[model samples]
Target: MFFIMTISNRKKQYIETVEKNITKITQYTIFNRTFRHNDRKFHKFLVEPDLNVLVVGIGNGDLLASLNPAVGVGIDISQKMVEFAAKKYQSLNFIHHDIDNKIDILKHPIVGKQKFDVVILSDQIGLCDDIQKTFENIQALCHSNTRLIISYYTKHWEWLLKLAEAVGLKVKQPEQNLLSTTDIEKIAELSGFEVIRKEYRQFIPFPLLGLDIVFNKFFGTLPGFRRLCLRTYVVARPHQTHEKKPYSATVVIPCRNEKGNIESAIKRLPQFCDNIEIIYVEGHSKDGTWEEVLRVKEAYPDLNIKAFQQTGKGKADAVHLAFSKATGDVFMILDADLTVPPEQLPKFYQVISSGQGDFVNGTRLIYPMEDQAMRFLNFLANKTFSWLFSYLLSQRFTDTLCGTKVFLGSDYKRIMKQREFFGDFDPFGDFELIFGASKLNMKVVEVPIRYQARSYGETQISRFRHGVILLRMVVHAYKKLKFSV
Candidate 1:
């Protein structure tokens, strides 16, 4: 009985010693150690704007200051750490709360609401005796939108980490984790968060017995190459966004006088496109384009429908007005003339869903088109532009003037922000998406959709008048993105 009592007592003391060592490291080593300038490693860990933030293991408060000014609070079990951070960033809120002492991070006012845009564990996670429990407490503070940034000592550093511990120097490490990259991921998921990005920095993040500080400086700039990348930095968010079922797309058809075509276009659209809401932008025209769109929308109430007028005369202007009303993960433009049919829109949707490319474009020239639809002169112009663009972009651009185009709405917003760089020159809107796609480096997938000529209403394109403008826009794109810095 005495022998068992002795062993139990020793084990308890041993655990206490490890806990004390961690608290000391949490307060001093992370915050007190600073470079001539701020540590670039810590600064790079901050990837997003911290509109509202919480520092889970607020060691030295160094990480908090580097981020965008945010309403933030920091908590550390160690009183010394709370005092240190308070003294440094007087503007910040620092309080002492032990992770193991029934003090969940989520219970804190700033965290409980999960209102933070970013929640940082930083090197603070290294000091925990129970890394998984600490991770769960941090996870509750993250909403579906929050970004959690964390890093910890790799298990491969066990020898050096033990040496640091022996010398009474603060060693930040995962709790006896022998942690591999996969281990980190499992723990994050168990804690109700999903790892979004995992980046390995370098093999050796610190100065070794043989390698000099100069080698460390060189590895820092190499960004790509390195051996002992110390710890992996994980950027994780809640997996709920990936789990939500995708919604069907909104297809916008801009109609002028294509009356004979509407009923067929409505029927031929694929079954997956059943939930597709078709909004027709009807510009003022002599034919009953408005009445025809109303007829199609009535036939398919399963497709939520809205029709509006385009005061401006161009297709580009019509797309701009139609898009203001679109709500879909995928936004597609279909010409009402059936040059590009509604059936082809499903392939575009599938291309995006399969993650083959962000933007799907229709290529009319891939297979020969109906001869009557494209006149001999228009054919020559299309061929010339296709060859020129393919050469310029170093990608197979089979057709540059095809009216049908498809893309994700979010990516479009990014491209649109800089649209003024290429002034609104193309009335067709084909070059605008092409130019934006080239600028964004978006993988452009050309789906071969059959093109048939309009059986009614005159073709809107003015070949001779638009040809000079198309040539000028290509020159402009070359100067702005390709040849310039």
Candidate 2:
């Protein structure tokens, strides 16, 4: 009986001490970059600006403050943590609120008519009794492009955590309704959302403080670490593609010459996948390209093909013009050259449905290309840029300029607002897509497919001049996304 009473007292003390330490986490913000990296890979790569946001946990989040949010909201069940954080970052909005109580997310005035650009729920998923309801409510709380970055501890960390609780250094709250990474993905996907990025990290961020970095890192890096890691960070966004109510997609194909492949391309492309509308933005072509596009449109009236002529002569210019005319939940870029087949578009569609990634890109490197498809000099540049971008963007992209990319329409809006950041210089539309996708923290995944050299037309990408321009983009991204962020 005496031992039981002692254990109960220790548990109480553990909660109290954790509440105190959390209140003063500004001291740990220096170490928080590593924390952010472990949560979102590209965040540490510094390709993104600090995200301005709110966290529904104990204390004001210094991590959010570092991002220069227009307003930051930090809430916690404990008044002690709220009070401490209030004094720390008094410039930002900090609220003392109990997450344990019933939350009518829609009823909240801050999100009633207005939703946050980003919302965070860190280290407090287990405190809420209704896990599904909590997320469903959070779903209601978000605008279309709103990003939610959440971190949580799982059952696998329970033993070590309980020991820390006994030592009065940690708190083990009751398992209200614990969930796995896959569980959360399913919940989000079913609720018109998808996991943009999911990471299992830091069994213990503070090695000397808790489990020690060695054992923590080992388990954290393990396969399915979500099965054992002390924490998980999941970034979810609205998956624009769904069956409940079919949404529209604008497939923009920019072609300059390449009449040889037009007939095959039109025939091979997916006719209808869920309200897909095909638009051909034909640039100035020396060949009979306009005639071919017209013939194809006449052949397939059911495809909803609209052919538009652009006065400008660049890929980015063509894309921009077509995008202004697009009215869809999703957008796609299909090169008129048809190096990558249109048949593979369903795979890109599947990527959106899977919720594993947000931006779908065609990767020609994974599959062998036809003879003379990529010249040696161009191949060298491709390899160099692939490595450079993977490091610069914190996302793996096997092909940087494959002429095929897709993303949600809402994300496009977010990118459009930040378009001035990367003026109108990208002729191939590669840098623009990559830069914007990384900025929004969208997970960019490669969809491997075969590549055939262009069947017609000369390549507009100058071997030397454009190569230098491309190189400059890389250096600029390093300065903007990497070092600055």
Best model per TM-score = 2
RMSD of each: 10.5, 8.1
Off by over 4 Å in 2: 1-53, 57-72, 80-117, 121-146, 150-245, 295-302, 353-356, 423-425
lDDT of 1 at 344: 79
TM-score of each: 0.51, 0.66
Error of 1 at 244 (Å): 12
- All models: lDDT? 0.65, 0.67
Predicted model with the maximum lDDT? 2
Which lDDT tens digits does candidate 1 get at residues 1-485? 00111122333443355465645644534323432122434433234344677776665676666565467777665555567778889987776665433344445564455467676775555455666777776655566556777766556777876777677564433345467767778888887776655544434444455353444444532334433655565666654533323656778888887777767776776766446767789888678888887887778777677888898997888888888888876788888888887777878887776655657888887776786878888889988988877644435688888878888777677567557656666677777777776544455779997888777778877889888888887776655543331
> Candidate 2, residues 1-485: lDDT per residue as tens digits?
00111123333553466565663443444345455545444223322344446677743455555556665666665556666677777886665444333243334555345467677777666555555566666666576657877677665666776776587554345433457777777876775666776655565555355454564545554444524665666777765533332446888888887777777776887744567777788888888888888999999877777888889878888898888888877788888778788888877876665555678988888878899888988888888899888766656777897888987777788787667665655677778888888767787878998888877767767899988888888877766653433
Predicted structure 1: lDDT:
0.65
Clashing pairs in 2: 46-481, 47-481, 207-213
